[model samples]
Target: MITTHAAIEDNIKRYKRGELIVPSDFRGKGTENAIKKTLSRLAADGTIKRLGHGLYVLPKKDPLFGEILPSTEEIAIALAKKEKVKIKPAGAFALHKLGLTLQVPTKLVYLTDGNGRIIKVGKNTIRFKSTTPKKMALKGELSGLIILALEELGTDQIDESTKLKLSNLLEKENPIILKQDLKLASAAVHDFILKLILNK
Candidate 1:
């Protein structure tokens, strides 16, 4: 007979390996109350952190600090994956990486192909916005970051220095897949950057 604590331990191990397990995963073989109780006990012991009502994750360790680093995206991805929803990091996350925005956004947003929701992980909020999967995927990781930056910075904000730096970085990274698409979408900024690069 598998005890509730034993089951919880097994689930925890699975979660550490990047598997998302829900209460039903264990309840299918045991009493729902037993599984819930065990989960609660594990959460209280810090073996798992409860993201929201039913979402949970095994805390990831920070190698440098030897402590758990709180990240809303990681939890959100785990939850979305378990729920069979497709999600891609977007908005501020992409913008910050693109150097178009200097501010670190408090909320981690993602474009998804399912219902949107706000998930609370610790004190951080993860937001999901429903969008076509093609659009979500087309915004390659770096392109998405650039788009976010451009959105925040606006077209006129692409000054000479910033344009040169961005162009150089993009060239180095060879983000050709998104170059034409992003340029077409951001005509003003694209022309400005092109002129600056030519003049330099």
Candidate 2:
């Protein structure tokens, strides 16, 4: 007879390295306690790495980086997919995603329609902050991220080079979607984006 731990270990072998694993993935294979215990054991044995509470991944080894782990953004997006919720990059993370910032933040923040929580993965932290529906309803792919970054920086912090960078970034966005997203922006952001669009 296959032991519960053995069965789980075999199942984990089928997953690609770096794929996200959650308890729900093994729902019918064993009891909740059995699965959790087996997963903990796997993590302890270096077969898989525990990311946050209830999150695990099969470890991937890179020649230069040693053990390659998923980025914080990837983990948050995976969690949102599992929970069937929506998430939007916010604050410093938004800036970093837009290439407006050179340094990666130790704490990544996202706006979500679901419950807010914090999860620490190694030295970095992922924060999901509950936000209003309106903020989550942004239309453009790039425009929404730009709005978040600008809001975090505020109007006073924006400078000539920053505006130039934003204008260049805005060039790649769909004009219709960009215009639609501008309506959702704050007064300052709306005006700023409008000027960029017009100047384009």
Candidate 3:
């Protein structure tokens, strides 16, 4: 068996240059204490970042830009992956991603099938709100994003320009995927999406 220190070092190589690291990732790789010690050492040496309570990431650097920390969305997605859970960007973040808005919300929200938690990275605060499986059905789909953005702004708040923006976005999505996403949206949002795509 490899030594404790060596096991942690070898495991670090498994992550990509900018990938996030979580404890559960090495559950079976080595003894809990050994892995903890190894990771602590790396963090102290500035070889890796301690993002939060049990979150860490291999920081990426650019020659011109220097260190580039992971974005709130990236960190959230990584956490979901490590836990084998589903998470979809919600509210303002969704609208921003879909090109419907330019404002970046202070708090990034994600509807998740996993338990709720918050992770703070600099000025970005990532929040995971536990939601039902039904809501997470389209986690990675564009339609899911549309629904969240629409819900956040509300039907009454959707201006003509915003609707047009959504129309253009829907036009670019694969027809089959659009149909699948429509099936997963709420009834009102489903009708709205149909109207947008059909140009009605």
Candidate 4:
């Protein structure tokens, strides 16, 4: 029979290098304490790097930079998993992710189905804001992001250049998927996405 550490190690081998991991991911695999002990040993071995409280990651090492830290998105995804909720980029971060904004947001917000929580990682702040079911309906989809980005930019504020870029992105999506995802948006956001799609 495989030992607890061996089994945990085997399971960890499946995670990509630099992937964030939490103890909850090992649920049903072993006792909570056993998993924690195994993780502690692995962390000491430098096989995994411990992040904030209860957060660990298999660091991605670069030849010149040594171990690279995980991105905000990676950390946010881990938080969402820990909270057992779906999350999506919100406010200026959504526009930034889409290359519409050159400005990097100092604080990142994610609309989540879970309770609001705040986490500080390095110099950045990650916040999860509880949102209605409709706001989170397409949390995992491309269109959901478009809605949030447009909401951040507002219709009048979106310049011609931004509209062109947004239009081009919508052109690449499947019509059926786009139509389905748009249903999750509010009426105003839906109208904006429709305009972007039709104008492309």
Candidate 5:
């Protein structure tokens, strides 16, 4: 039988490296229950945080701000991979990527076609939205991100400068693969992207 303290130490070491582990990770040699108990104790001690269900992460500390660290989207991606689900940044994440917004979003939104759930890490929330993989793949990063930004910005937000920047970036990135689908996009999305490309 693995000792509770030893298991807790080992778990903390693994979590420090950005690994998310559950009781199953300790499944061998009849250590599952002991490991779960140890994990709960550690969580109560603030050595790690519970991210919902059986998910947990080692909290990172920010030196400059003297506070707990911000949520790492990479961790979210890794979690999705562990759950065998495909995910892409959406909403505020997409907005930030488009250079249209500078706010640090507290909620990490991901587009996925799989089951959706809300995960709480420390004081922040990470939300997964169930969306078709095609929609997730569409907008194709830069263009998609720009589209999301425009959606948040509304119709009048598609100014000449925003169009020029978006066009240049799209031309450089070349999201032509998304064009056919873009034709069927919302009127604002289709018109804005097409006009930017044509005008240039």
Candidate 6:
């Protein structure tokens, strides 16, 4: 008979390096405590890395960096994929991603069409805020990030320099996709972005 620990270990090995793991992934192999214990044992032996409560990963090895732990963005993307949810970067993080800001935010925030939750991974915190389906309907990568970043800056805060930067970015986006995504934006954002698109 295969022991619970052995069974769980085997299942974990099937995952690719840097793949996230949760106890629920081993549901049928053992009882909840046995599964948790097995995961803890593996993490203790360096076979896997314990990220935080209920999160583990098969650490990827890098030549220079040694252990290649996942970034907050990577973790958020993985969690969204696993949960079958849609997520887009929001707030200060969105601004930073769009080159509107140079500072890196310590806490990462994403708007999701799924339940809102906070996950702490090492020094970083990943926040998923529940949002409407329309907000999640953005089809263009550049357009989505621009909308979120603009929302973070707000109408009053936008200046000539910022508008210039946005205008430059708008040139890189596909006109068709940008036009389609604009329909999903709030009235203020739609009008703001349309003005830029029209001026281009």
lDDT tens readout by residue for model 3, 1-200: 77877777788877787888876667777788777777888889988888776678898889999878787777888788878888788888999888777888878888888899888877778898898787777733566788877766666778899888888777777778778777777788888888887774
Clashing pairs in 5: 139-144
Give the per-residue Cα lDDT of candidate 6 at 62. 90
Candidate 4 residue pairs that clash: none
Q: How well does candidate 4 score on lDDT at residue 163?
A: 84
lDDT of 6 at 200: 66
lDDT of 6 by residue, 1-200 (tens): 89889998888879999999988888889899999999999999989999988899999999999998888788889989988998899878987888888987889999999999999988889999998888788888788888876765576678888887888888898989988888888889889988876786
Error of 5 at 35 (Å): 6.1
For candidate 5, the C-alpha RMSD (Å) to the true structure equals 4.2
Pairs of colliding residues, candidate 2: none
Q: What is the lDDT of residue 160 in candidate 1?
A: 68
RMSD of 1: 4.4
Q: Give all candidates' CA lDDT scores.
A: 0.64, 0.87, 0.79, 0.80, 0.68, 0.87
Model 3, position 49, has a per-residue lDDT of: 89
What's the C-alpha lDDT at position 181 in model 2? 84
* Model 6 RMSD vs true structure: 2.0
Q: Which of candidates 3 and 4 is the stronger one according to lDDT?
A: 4
Q: Model 3, which residues run further than 4 Å from truth?
A: 1-10, 28-38, 139-141, 174-180, 194-199
* Full-model lDDT, candidate 2: 0.87
Residue range 2-80, candidate 1, lDDT tens digits = 7877966875685553344568667565688888788777878988766666665666666686546445666677778
**Evaluation by TM-score, superior candidate among 5 and 6:** 6
lDDT of 4 by residue, 109-170 (tens): 88888889887777788889888887777633556678876665577777889889888877
Model 2, position 172, has a per-residue lDDT of 91
Q: Specify the highest-lDDT model's number.
A: 2
What clash count goes with each model? 2, 0, 0, 0, 1, 0
lDDT of 4: 0.80
Error of 6 at 197 (Å): 4.0
Compared with the true structure, model 5 gives a TM-score of 0.69
